[model samples]
Target: MEHLILTRDLLNTSLHQSRQIDFEIHKTAANVTRINHAFPSLEAAIRNMACKCATFGIRNHVDRALPTVSAVFKVSQVVNELGKLVSTHSASDLNLYLSLVKRFRQALTLLTNTCKLAIPWVEDVKLFLLDGTTDLGVGVDHDHPYQSNVCKTLHLLEELQGTEERSLLDQGILGVAFNKLEDEFRRLLIHNSSPLQVPSYLFSSGDEESDASDPLPPPPLPFPIVQNLRAIAVCFACDNQLDQCMSIYIKVRSTIVKASLQGLDLGYLDISLSEFDSVQEIEGYIDEWGRHLEFIVKHLLELEYTLCHQVFGQLDVWTDCFSKIALQSGIQGFIKFGNTVTKGKKEAIKLFKLLDMFAALNNLRQDFNRIFGGTPCSEIQTQTRDLIKKVVNEACEIFQDLSAQVELQRLTDPPPDGSIPKLVSFVTEYTNELLDNDYRPVLNQVIKIYSSWYDNNKFTKRLVSLEVHNIVKSLERNLVTWAKRYEDTGLSYIFMMNTSCYFSKHLTGTNLGDLMGESWIKRHQNHVEYYATLYLRESWGKISALLDNNDGDVKKRIRGFNEAFDQVYRKQSGWVLCDRGLRWETCQLILQVIIPVYKRHIQNYLALVESEVSPNKYVKYSAESLESMVTCMFQPKLDKYENSTKYTNLMGKIKNVVAGRFSPTTAAA
Candidate 1:
C-alpha cells in the first residue's frame, strides 16, 4: 500500500511538472502585458496584466517586476514625447490601464499567513484514519486472500467525499467541505477514550517466523492519495483568491478512482499528529458559591446527577495522578489536528459525541447479545473494563513516577549549585499506548539543550554573546552548587530560578543543552516556550498546512492570554497594587522596556498578503504568540519599580551576562 501510494504521489508530481501549470501562468501574465495599446509605459503594461482572472503563482512574479516596468514606462514616455506623442486618453482608459497594472502588481505579492490560533496544550492526539481486516478461503479454488467489504468501503468513502477530495491541496471554495472532511476524519481516527495515535507501520523482517498458525490479515485498502500541502496563493485583501485548491486536488485524486477500478490491494499511511504547547493565563473560576448556584439550582435541568457525580468522581481520581506530576494546564487548540472541534459548549459537545460513539458500540454489543444473548457486560466485559482500568492505572503511575523524578531534581538543583540544568517533559502517554499496540513507542523523548547566562545565579547574570556559551555552563554549575547548599527550594529560590531561567534560556532563539542538561523534565523550559510558539514558526504562505499555521493560533491564544492577563497581571494596569491610583513610576520603566522591544519587532508581522505564488502566505505579522510574554512579564511589574528595586541589580547582571561590556576590539580602541 505504501509503495502504491508512493506511485500515486510520484504520478501527481509528474503531472504537475508535465503540465507546467505555473509556467503557463507566467506566459499568460506576460501575454497580458502586451494586450492593449493603451499601456504607454512598462509599469502601466505590467499593472494591467491581471485584468483577467489569474492564478497567484504566476502573477506574483509580475508584481515583483513592477519597478523595472515603471522605469521602462518612464523611458517609453520620453521616447513617445520625442516622437511628438501627447496624452490622448480618457479617464475610463486610464482606469482600464491602472486596473491592468494593479492586477500585475497584485500578482507579484505572495500571501503568507502566520496561523496564530492558540492550539491549546493537548496531552496528545492520535487520529487513525486507516483500518482493515481479512478472511481466508484456503480451498483448491482459492486464488488470493479474500478482502471483505473493506476495499469497497474505502472506495465508497473516497467517492462520497469527492468534492472534499478535490479540495485537499486547496483551502478555499469549500471551507465547509474541507471542514466536514476534517471533522469526519477526526471522528474515524480519534477515540473518546484516548488520543488518535496509531500503530507503527508494519515492516517485514527477514528470517522472522511467520504466523502460519493464524494467518495474517489481508492488507488495508490502497493508501489515500494526499499532497504534502505546502502553500497556496490567495488575495487576503478582497478575499479574491477563493479557497479553490480543491480543483487541483480533485485532478490529482483521479488516481484513487483508477486504483479502485483496478482492484489494487494498496494500503494507507497517516501523518503523525503534530504536538505543540502554549502557556495562557487561566480564566476566572467562579469558586464554590458560583458552582453551587449553577449546579444546585439547576440540578433538575441536569437530571443526570448520578452520572455526573460518577464522572466527577472519576475525574477526581484521574486528576489526582497529576498532583505529584507538577502538571499545569494551558489553552488547547480545538480543531488543530486536521480535526475541527465544533465550537460552543465544547466540553458538553465532546461528551455528547462520545455518547454517540458509545451508543454505536452499544449497538455492536447488542449484536453480540444476539449472537450469544446469554452473555452479560459484567463477566465477558471484564476484559474491556480491565483494559481501561489497566491503562488508566499505568498512566497515573507513570505520571507520578515522572513527576517524582522532576521534583527530586528540583530539590537537588538550585542556583549556585553544580552543573544542573533546566528540563521539561511532554509525555504523550495516551498516544504512545494507543498507537503502539505492538507496544513499540513511536514518539520517544526528543531532547535538545544549549548554553546561556542569567540562569541559575542569585541574580539575573547577563553575559555578552561572545562569552555566553561558557557562562551558560557556569550557570549550570552554579545551579547544582546551590542545590547542594539548600533543602528543597520549592516556592522561593526554585521558583526564582525557574522564572529567571525561563527568561534567560528561552526568550530569543533556543539553546538545547540548557533545555536538556540536568533534570530533563524538572529543568526543561526552552522548548517553544512562548504562549504562541507555533505562530512564530513560518513567515510565509497564505494557506498553512493546517497543522502549523501560527496566524490562526496566535489570535486564539492572545485572547485567552488577555482574559487571563486582565485578572492576573493588569487588573490594575492603570492603578497601583496596594494603592488606588495609577502606578506611574513603575509604568515608566516598563515602557522603557516595552517601547524598545515593540519598536524593534512588533509590526514585523503582516496583516494581508496578495500572492500569485505558492499557497502559504508571507507572514507579515511577527511577535504574535509573544502576547503572553508581553502581558505576563510586562504589566505585572510595570509600575512595581519601587518594590522591584532589588531585581534592578539582578536585571543589570542579566544585561551584562547577555550582552557584555565590550569586545576586544572596542576595549583596545
Candidate 2:
C-alpha cells in the first residue's frame, strides 16, 4: 500500500509537469487556426491521459477492496461456525463443552487483538501494513476511520451470525454447565466416597516414632474425576465465574463430607447428654467417638482436604472450600461428643472413657492442627482444644471423687471366707488399669492441669504414685474399719491378713507397683505378716496355755488341754485363708506350738496317768493324728459347718471306745 501511494504521487507529479510544458507552449504565439487545432489535440491527449490514470486508480481501489471484502467474509464464516458449535453442544458433554470453551476463548483473544489494531497515523498503519513489525506503542486511537470500519465490520458479522448474543448465550451455557458440573461433582464425590475406615495401624499404640515414620497423605480422588473437575474449574476461572465455581464446590462437597461422616453410623454421635441415664449408657458411645474421631481427623477430613486441593488447586478456593467442608463434616460431631462425655454425670466410672477420649485427641493433636490450620478452621481447632481440656478436667474430678468414695466406703461386713473384699479388689484393679502405661501419662496430664499434684509440666511418677497411694491408703483405712465388723477376733485378724495379702500380690508387678514403689509392697506384706501373727496369738493362745506345765493335777491339765484343743479345732476348721502360702503358714504356726507342747505334756506327764486312767481317756489323739488334724485346719469347704454333726459323732465314738477300754471291771480283769 505505501508503494502504491508513492507511485500515485509520482504519476501526479509527472502529469503536472506535462501540463505546465503544454501551457508554456500554448503561451508562444502562432497562427490562430493552428493554435486552436493544436489546443484541441493537446486537450484530447490530456483527456486521454486523464482517463487512463482514472482507470489505473479504479484498478488499484479494486485490488485493495477485494481482499478486505473476502477477509470479512471469511471472518464471518469462522464466527458462524464457532457460534453454532457453542450453541449446539451441551455442557453435560463436559469434554466437548470444555473444547468449545477453549475455542471461544481463543476467538475472544483474536477479537481483542483485532481491536488493538486501531493505529491512527498513516505512517504507523503503512508500517503495520508492510510487514506487521510496528508495535505503535500504546497510542492506538479506536476512533480512527480504519479502526471504526474494522469494528463495524466485526459488529456486522456478529449481527449476521447472532454472535453478539454469544457472550450472554455462553454465560447461560456456563451457568448450566457449572450447575451440571456441580451435580456431577457431588455425584462423583458421593459415589466414590466410602467411609474411610480408620486403618487398624492408626489405632495402634500411638507411638510417636511409629506415627512419624509412617506418615500418610490423604488418599486421592479417582484420576478421571480429578481431571474432569480440574478442567471444569479452569474453564470457570477463565470465564471469571470462579466465585460461582467455588460456591458450588463448597456447597456440594460440604454436604458430601457431612454425609460421608454420617455414613460411619456411629450412633453414639447422636446421643445427647439428657438422653444418657448413666455413665455405662454412654460408655460405648465414647469408645466409638474416640475411634470415629481418629477416623475423621486422620482419614475423612484428610481425604476431603486432599480432594479439594486436587480439584481446585488451580483456583484460589481450595483452602476455603476444605475449611467449610471440614466444619460441616462430622469433625464437630466428634468434638461435641467429647464435650458431652465430659459434661455428663461425673462418676468415677466415666473417668476411664474420658481418659480414652483425651488420649485419642492428644494423639491426633498434630494431625488436627495440620489439617485445620487454615484461618477459617479456627472454630474447629478451638473447640477441639476446649473439648480436650474439658475431658482432662472432668477426668481429674472423677479420679478425685473416686478417691473420696474409697475413703468413705463404710461397708461393715468382710467377705464371708476372709478373702479379699470386693471394694479392695475393685479399687486396686481400677487403679492398676488407670496407672497403666497408656493411661497413666494422660492421667498425670489431667492431674497436672486440673489439680495441684506435681505443679509442673514434668511427668513425675510421684503424681500417679500419690494418686495410687491415696487410693490404697483409703482402701486400707476402709479395710481396717471393715475388719472390726467381724465378731470373732481371730476372724478379724484373718480378714486383715487376706486384704493385705491381696494388696501386696496385686501391686507386685504392674504400673501401679512401679508408681507405688517397692515400699508400698513391703508395707502391705508387713501388714499381712502382722495380721498373721495377731491371728495366731488370738486363735491358739488359749490352746497353748492349756499345754503349759502348771504342776497342778496332771489329769486336770490333760483334760483341760484336750477340751480346749478340741474346741479350737472344730471352730477354725471352717475358716478360709485365700492365699495358699498364707494358709500353709497359718497351719504351720499353729502346729509348731501345738505339737511340741502336746508331745511333752502327754508323753512325759500323761504316762503317770496312763496306768490309773487309760491314756486313751485323756489323750484320744496320738501325736501323728494330732499333726494330721492341724494340717486339715483352715481348708475351706462349703459343707464343713453342716457336717459338724458327723465330727461330733466320731468324737463320741472315740470316747466310748476309751471308756470301754478303761472300765473299772475290765481294769480288774
Candidate 3:
C-alpha cells in the first residue's frame, strides 16, 4: 500500500515537471521560427560571400566549408523540430518528453560549437549588420566565408532586430532546456535523500567515540543520479544559468535538510518559552537539545556541508549554497532554542542544563567556524557566538545565585530527630552534580570569567572550587541559624553534629569530596567531635555533677542523681544521629566521662546501699548498668503511637515496682 502511494506521488511530481518543461518548450518554439526565417537570409549572405571568395581566388577553401555549413544548418533544423515535439508532449508521457529534451540538448550543443568556430568571420558580418554593409573589402579574401554561414545566421537574427523575425534564442530556447535540468536536479535530490541514523556520540560520553579526528564525509549519492546531476550542472553553466540552478538547489536541499532535522523528534525546538510553566520544565528538552545540537553540528550539518562541495564545486558556489541551507535548516533552530533558555528564569537546576548546551556548542566551536565561517554565513556565525555568550552569562548568574539560594533557606525548625535538615541535603546533592566531570569544566569557565575570587588572586584551588566552597559555606551558615531554634542545648549540638557529620561522611568519594578535600572532611569531622564535647558537657556533665555534691544528704543526692539520670535518658533516647559511626562515638564520649566518676562517688555510699532492705530505689542501677543506659541514647524514636504508649506504661510499672518494694504500706502488708 505504501509503495503504491509513493509511486503515485512520484508520478504526480513527474507530471508537474513535464508541464513546466512543456510550457518552456512552447516559448522556445517561437524562437525556433525566428531562427528558421533567419536561415534564408544567412544562406543568401553565405552565397554572396562565396561569390566574393571566387573573386579573390579562394573558392576551393570556401567550397570545402560549404558542407560543414550545411551540417550546422541541419542541426539547427533538428533543434527546431525537437522544440515542436517537446511543446506538444503530454504531461502523462513525461519519459518521452524528457527523452526529447535530451535530444534537444544534444542539438543545441552541436549548434553552439559551430557558432564558436565561425565567430571570427561573424565579426565582419556583425559590423555589416551595425552599419548595413560589409566592412571587409570585396578584393580581400573573405577568410573562410563558407565557415561563416552558421555565424551569419545568428548575426542575421541580430541585424533583423526591428523585424518580426528577431530570434529569442538566449532567453527562449536555452531557457527551456535549463528549466528541464532544474526540475531534474530537484527530482534527483528529493528522491535520493534518506533519514540519517542516530550517531553514538550524541548519547555517549563527550566525543569519546565520534572524535573530530575521525571525520565522517557525506555518503555518496547514487552513481547514475550523480552523473545526471553533473551533466545538468554543466549544461546550466554552458547556458549561462548557474544562478538559476544554484537557487533551485539551495531551495530543494534546504527543505530536505530541515525535514531531516525535524525527523529526529525535536519539535520542542519550535516551542515558545512562555509555553513552559517553570524553568525546570524545560530541563528534559534542554538535555535533548544538547544531544541533538552536537549530533547535528558534528555529523549531520558537517555531512551536508561536505555534500555541497561534492555536488556544486564545479560552479565554485558550494560554500554559498551550503551556508544558506545550513542556516535555514539546522543551525538557526538550535540557536533560537539556546537563546530562549538563556532568557529563562535563573535557577540552579537550569544551570546544569545550560552548561550541557554550552559544552555541546563549545565542543563544536572549531567545526562551526570551519563550516559556516565566511561572509555568506556571517549571520549564522554571529548568532551562534552570541548564543554561546548568553548561555555562559546565564549559567554564571544562576551558579553565583546559588549562594543566595542557600542563604534564603531560613527554616526555623530543623529535623525533629536531630537529623540533617532538608536544605543541607539539597545543597549537598546539588553541588555534587555541579562538580561532575561533564559539568565541571563548563562551570569552571563560567567561574573564571564571572567570579570575583578569580581576579588578581593566586589560589591553589580552581575558581569553580571556590564557588562551590562558598555554596557549602552558605549551607553551613544556614545550619547555624537553624540549630539556634533548638531550645535544648544538647539537642542543638546533636543537630549540628548530625549535619556536619553527614556533610563529611556522605560527600566522601564524590566529586564534591574531591573538591573539598580530606581537610574539609576532617574539619567537619572535628566539628562533630566539638559538638559531641559540648553535648556531653551540657547534657551528661550536669547529670554527673549531681554525684559531686559533698553534703551529708547521701540518700538525697542518690535520689537526685537517679531522677536527673532518668529524665535525661528518656529525653535524649528519642533523638537520632543519622550517621551510625558518629552516633556510636557520641554515645561512647558521654559514657566515658560520666560512668567512672559516678562509680567512684557511689563507692563512698556503699554502706547506705547495703543497709536498705530494698536499695534499688536510691541506687537505681549499677555502674555497668548506667553505662549501658547512656550507650542507648540518640537512637531512633518509636514510630507507632500504640508502641509508644505501651513503652510508657511499661516504664511506669517498673518505676512503681522499685518505689513500692520498700514502702511502709508494703511492710505492713
Clashing pairs in 2: none
Candidate 1: list runs displaced more than 4 Å: 1-200, 204-380, 397-405, 410-499, 503-669
Candidate 1 residue lDDT tens string, 1-669: 534555565556545643453354355334334422333432233345433214433244334434433443343333222211111121123334333323422322211010011001000000011111211112212121111121222222222223222322232212222332322222221211111111112122212433455333222111221111211212111233222332332222232222222321111111122212110000011111122112211221122122222222222221221111111110011112112111111211122222222222333444333322223223334433333232223322332233233233333333232111323101111112212322112111100000112123322212222223333344344444444464423212332333334433332232333333345433344321321122122110111222123455543433443344334333223221111121232233333433344334223222222233532243323344333333333232223222321231221222222111111111111
Best by lDDT: 3
Model 1 scores worst on lDDT over the 10 consecutive residues at 118-127
TM-scores for all predictions: 0.16, 0.66, 0.69
What is the lDDT for 434 in model 1? 19
**lDDT-best of 1 and 2:** 2
Give the C-alpha miss distance for residue 323 in model 1, angstroms. 42
Alpha carbon lDDT of each predicted model: 0.26, 0.62, 0.66
| Per-residue accuracy of model 3 over 1-669 as CA lDDT, tens digit each | 433454476678667766776576566556567767777677777777768656543445445555555566676677667756654554234456557766766666666666555444445443443342333343323244544564555564333331212222433544544454566676677677654666545555343556555435447476666666666666667546678778877776776566556557777887676523334656667867877887778767787787777777787778888888887776788799888887666655567678788777878889988998868888998898788777767777777677876666653456766776645655666677777776787777655554443354332337678888998887788788778887888888999888787767777777788888899899998998899889889988887888786875877888888899889888877788766677778878888877887787677677667877775556778988887776776765532211211121222232222122112221111
Off by over 4 Å in 3: 1-176, 199-220, 251-255, 271-278, 328-330, 404-417, 428-436, 448-461, 472-485, 503-523, 547-559, 591-632, 636-669
Please report the candidate that would top TM-score against the real structure. 3
Question: What lDDT is obtained when candidate 3 is compared to the true structure?
Answer: 0.66
Mind sharing the TM-score for model 1?
0.16
Name model 2 segments beyond 4 Å from true: 1-79, 90-96, 105-219, 222-224, 240-265, 273-278, 410-417, 451-461, 480-487, 514-520, 549-559, 569-574, 599-629, 635-669
Give the number of colliding residue pairs in candidate 3: 0
